[model samples]
Structure formats: structure tokens, C-alpha cells
Target chain A: MTDTITIDDHQVPFEAGQTIMEAARAAGLYIEHLCYNPAYQPHGSCKLCSVKVDGVIQTACTMPAIAGQKVESDSPEMKSRRKTLVEMIFAEGNHYCAFCIKSGSCDLQALAYHLDMHENSFNHRYPVRVIDASHPDLILDHDRCIFCGLCIRASRDQDHKNVFTMAGRGKATRLAVNSETGKLGDSTIAADDAAAHVCPVGAIMPRRGAYSTPIGERYFDARGIDEIDNASGKL
Target chain B: MRSTTPQGNCDVIQREPGQKIRIASCSLAGCFGCHMSMLDIDELVVEVVHHLEYCRGPLNDVRELRDVDVGVVEGALCNEDNVKVLEQFRANCDLLVAVGACAINGGLPAMRNHFGLTACLKEAYLDAEGVVNPEIPRDAELPRLLNRVRPIQEVVKVDYFLPGCPPPAAAFTELFTALIEGREPAFDEDMVRFD
Candidate 1:
């Protein structure tokens, strides 16, 4: 008998060491998330994937899947909470989606659309951040960084370059380059590095290729994130 | 129906049977792209006109903002005049709808929020390449610039928000048709976009 967990009334089978997120993804169920990419170790920083497991709230990416356990997601309460989390992320960063290069393909923007976040409920923090265009091929616009640390993990674990790191503490925490000058140009990150491609927002982007794909042809333009995620079967 | 007075007092305004819904619109610190999109409703304008009475919008030249059923606002509040106009719309209209991305999240104009007001003014006026005579305008008649550009919702209560760069004409059609037919307005997934 397979160990199966019920998520939003859907039976999702899981292996012994699998988390609820992995189980749900394998079952072709889409759970909204930002910091829980399957390419690296799950980091439950975003809290957008908070689910009710046996009537208790827990992060789906970190919570272990158990047989006969019922997880509550896709409910109105859960959706609303996820929307508020997205709104807070928008409020914290200077995400002007109107002109952002990653407006269409951005995971944060796509999740916002998927969660039906129409207006930001929180006041805009408008934190003053830097835009590092020092790299020959990449531009780091810190204004849009959500601090998911996907780049840090990808660089350290996958690329073995250690090009990125999370510096400071609390609200003052920021993405820092591992170089003497504290600039991306001085770092060993390449344009093809996994760290360069793992940014979920517009914070890290390759230069000279913006808006290459027209508005209607972009990802998330024709399909919602849920549909795309289900079709791709990736976490 | 109920309306708010300029003094911020609620007043009952009786609407006669078979009366058309009145609408007013304004553009502040944004481009008139949203108004252009509203106009792109094209042939549907004839049908819309039958149900709505234009009071003070780009379609009409009326300067005074009269009591209206819906007040559509486009753009962010970047100056004192924009703030005054938004307050006036809030006072006069029963339902205030933020029309586009500018009114909802400050859009492109709010990009100035990163640089301080002095820096922006200096860049535009004093540091530009074309320097015949660079001087920051400080005329008494000119509306005083706010320290930061803000979305309309930051200044007044907004009942509805139509998100997009300039919300697609289909979105307007949906909203207006729903309003005219006395149905609750809800956007399709494709209709709501930040860009």
C-alpha cells in the first residue's frame, strides 16, 4: 500500500522522505510557493505555501507528508492568506510591474495573478536599494529582490561559485555578491550560471534581451501559473 | 442614493426612475493612456451613452465635478492639484474606481520614489543636457509638487481598482456592461493585469 496524503481532498502519494510540497507536485497538484524550488533544498521563507495540515498551519515545503493526513489548501481562507503574503512582498519591495522586465515571466508576479491579488492592502515600504549594473552580462536590481535566496543556494551548491550570499539581519538583510569590491562584475558568476537563471523576480536579469518576446507571447500572459505549473509538473 | 458633500458630510440624493447613471473621470500625474483605452470601447460607446450620463470626463468638456454615480480616476497623485481633484471626486461620487496601474500602484511615475524629490527636480531642471536656462519653476500658480508620488488609494478611499497599464478595453466593457445591467462586476483572469 502506498503512503498517501489528502491535499484539498486530492489523494497525493508520497515516498517515505518526501515533503508535502514534493508529494503534491508529483501528484500534479499546484501549491503556491516562492522559496520552495525543487532544484535546491527547500527554504520556507516566503510562507506563501502555508497549508493547514490536520487543522494545524505549517509550511508545505518543510512539513513531512504522512499517511492519512489531511492538508487543507485552496480554501478561501488559505487563498486570502496567500494573497496577503504576496501583497506584503509587493509592499516590502519596489515592485513596479508596469515597467518591470520580468513582468510576464516573474514567479512573484505570476503568483500574485494566480492568487487574485488585485490591490496591495499594506502601505508601500519603498525601501531605498541599489541597482548593480556592474556585471558585463547581468544586471542586479535589488529593488525587486524578495530575498528567496534561490540564487545563493544555486551558486553555492550547483555552480560551486559561491557568487551570492544573504548579508545583514532582519529587514536590513540584502543579497550580497561574493567579491572584494562587493560588485557582481568582480564576482565569478557567469551569465549561464544556475544562480543567474534562478532568480524568481527581476532582481537578477541578463542584459540586452529585455522585452524580446512581445507582450502577449510572454509566459504567464496566455496561461495562469497553476495551468503552467500543472503542465510543466515542476516545483 | 447617497452623496458626500464638499464638507465631508453625507447627503441623500434621490434618483428618479429610469435615470441614467452619471460618470465623471479625471487624469492626474499620468499619461492619458487609460482615457484613450476607455475611448477604445469604440462602437460600444453608443450603448454606453444610453445607460450613462457623462458629467465631467474627457468625453465632455464640463469643468465642474457634479454628483455622479461612478468616478473613474487615472494616474497617481504627484502634486497638490492631483490631491485636490481626487478629494473632490471622492466627495461627489458614490463609487470611486481607480482606473489603471497608475491609480493603483503609482505606475511609472512612482519610479521617482527611489530618488528624492530634490534629486528628481535637479536631474530634470538643472542637470539635463539641453541647458538654455535651467531653473526649477516655483511660480505661485503652479501646483506644489509632493515629496513622493502616491497612488490614489493612498490619498482617498477607492471602491474598485481596474489593474493594467491602461486596463484593456475589454475590461472597461465588462465593468460598464455589468454596471449598466445591474450585475456585480467581476474581472476574468485575463482582464486583470499589472502591466
Candidate 2:
């Protein structure tokens, strides 16, 4: 028996428990994703990699690609809906592109621009967000955070230290520091932790060079990140 | 249906060489970042001025107001004065534009609303260390603060909303062109941010 699946009319083999996104990517099919890092477990929050599987939009990162399963990626309807998902993330979060330290290079803003988000179509819901400056070497701007949980899962699975946890629910749910004092400084996590750098927005930034990266050479446009092979290059 | 003609019935008259339009802008109870972004229009500023009237404001040089075809309001109503200023702009100009997040959704400054106006003012004035007069002003003439700052739409109906912390420069250009052409505003999909 073969562990394989048919994706977009192509029969592709996959390992057991492998997600449709991973299998598709392995087959050289590009699926738009921001939250799924190959180096880490899927954070499935981005919803950008959503593809029609059995005629339903589901996160490819978390959803397993099965045998004889059908998948669609390049459809016009899928493209439009994907763009809307990316836009919703831009609107829900306090993604101030101008004031953001990660402006040019930030994944969130870059993805938004790439997806062609010109105006915020949704009625603006400016939720009250708090900034955490407890950690001396790292800053956590909750407003810019999209709750992707890359940091949270990375800290637990890779670092062997569970430092960050989600607190509250719904719009009030926020990433909280796991420590006796409930402050990031008191946590066992280090400034150079994989969790710190995994932040998509300008949320968890190194203290010293927090805003040192100039506007032009920052993160997104001309100064943007090398997204092609960042996992292997930086890791 | 205030204007079936869209914006106004005025037609673009032929102008001699170097002739420009006049424009006026203001920033009230909000960070002037929106104005900076407006000025960031760079060469487009010259183009905007060519077709509109421009006037300097009583406060900042960048801030201005004049009787013109369009009046841009770049802040939310935090007090009675804001209401009056909005009404003045609405009355004086054929078009009123709310620019940026401050003008659109009250921006970060409106975050103070969670604390209420009195507590916010008290925290800055009375609770602070060095102050000539720590006492809250008992004057009746001065405009009293609202319970909370709200978007311009809440106080008065806004003609157009260009939402962003400061709207993207590209959208700014498109909106300006649309306004000048007397066409319905174009909100490019590229300018929309949702999250």
C-alpha cells in the first residue's frame, strides 16, 4: 500500500500524518502560507493556506492530505478568499505599518501587500492591546501579534522550556508569560530563544537593536526578509 | 440624494500655465502623522495645489484651513470644539474627507477612552509631579472633554473614510485623483488591510 494522495490532478506520495500543505509543498506546489514553518509544528492561525478539500476551506497545514483526496489552490474564488483571509488578519491586529519596527521586513505586512490589501474593508474594531516591556532584552507588542503561537509552541517543543501561554478568551485572549512573577524577564526563556525570533510581526523584538533596522532596509519591501530559505539559512 | 451630479455640479475650468488649485487641512486632537503622510505625497502636493486653494492654519504651518472645494479633517471628536470644527468644515466645503485612523476610528489616542476623560486628564495634570497649577480648570468657557473620543462618523456623517494608521501613499494619490476628476473614490484592493 502507498501513502500518497491526488492533489490538483497530480498523484503525490506523502508520509503518514503529513499535512496536505507539506505534501503539496514537497510536490513543488506553492501554497500561500505565513504561519506554517517547516522547522516547527503548524500554528494554523494564519488561515492563508486554506484550500478546498472535499469542497470545504480548511487549513492545509493542520489538515492531513489523504489518498484519492482532491485539492484546489489556483482557482479565482480561492484566490479572492485567500486575499480576504490575509486582509482580516491585517485588520484584526494593530498592524501599524508606519510605526512598526519590522515594517519593510515584517512577514504580516509583506504578506498583506503581496495579497494586495489596499483598504481595510472591514468595519474597524480597534481592540485595546497592551505592550509587555517586562523582558529587558525583548519587547512584546501584543497589538501587532496575530496569535500565531509560533513562539509558544517553539518554546515548548524545541527549547524544552514552556515559557509562553495564551490567557483569556476571544478578543481578550492574549499571549502571557509563564513564570512565577508572570513576567517574561522572570521566565526561563532567553533573549535569543527560537521563540523570540519566530514572531511574524514586530511583537517580540531584541531590546538593543529593536528599532535599529532603518526604514528602507528593515523587513518587507527592498529591505525585506529572504523568505525563500530563511528556515535553513537562519536556523 | 443631495447631489445626483456626484460631489458637485462644478466643472473644471481651463487654467493658464503655472496656475494651481488651493487646499487647506487641519489636525485636531490627533497626532499630526496623518498630515506628515499627506505631505509625504511629495510631488503630488504640487499637483493637488494646482487644482485647489491652500491656506495656513492658526496653529501649525502644516495645519491649514480655507474656503475650498474640499476640506480634509484628520482627527476624531474628543470635545465640543471638535464638533464645532467638524460642523464648520462640513458647512464651508462641498466635500469633507476624514483621513487616517485618528479621523477614521479615533486611532491609538482614543485608547484613553477606556479610562474615561476625567481619569485621563487627572493622571496627566493632577497626579503629575511638576506643574504650575495641579488644579483641574474650573472655567466654564473652556470646552469640556467628552466621556470618550469617537470616530468622526459618530459625531457627524463623514463624506469619505480613508482608513489606515496613516493611509498608504498609493491610496492617497488615487483618492486625490478621484476627487479632482469628480469621480467616485477608488479603494484599491491593494490598500485594504484586515487583521
Name the 10 consecutive residues with the lowest summed lDDT in model 1 chain A.
A226-235
Q: Which segments of model 2 are wrong by more than 4 Å?
A: A1-17, A27-34, A67-95, A118-130, A223-235, B1-24, B36-50, B53-71, B83-96, B111-116, B151-173, B181-195
**Interface RMSD measured for model 2:** 7.1
Which docking category, incorrect, acceptable, medium or high, applies to candidate 2?
incorrect
Q: Give lDDT tens digits, candidate 2, residues A1-235.
A: 7777776677878988889988987887777777788888887877888889978888999998787778887677877787777767765766656455665556766665555544444544556677878887888888778887888888899887999988999877788889998878889888778888787667787777646755444434342222442221121
DockQ (Cα-based) per candidate? Answer: 0.44, 0.16
Best by TM-score: 1
Q: Model 1 over residues A1-235: C-alpha lDDT tens digits?
A: 8989999989889999999999999998889998878888988899989999999999999999999999999899999899889988998889988888888888888898898877876777778898999999999999999999889989999999999999999889899999999999999999889898888888999898897878888877888878775211111
Name the TM-score of chain A in model 2: 0.87
| DockQ for candidate 1, C-alpha atoms | 0.44
- Candidate 1 error regions (>4 Å): A230-235, B1-15
Output the number of the lDDT-best candidate. Answer: 1
Error of 1 at B80 (Å): 1.0
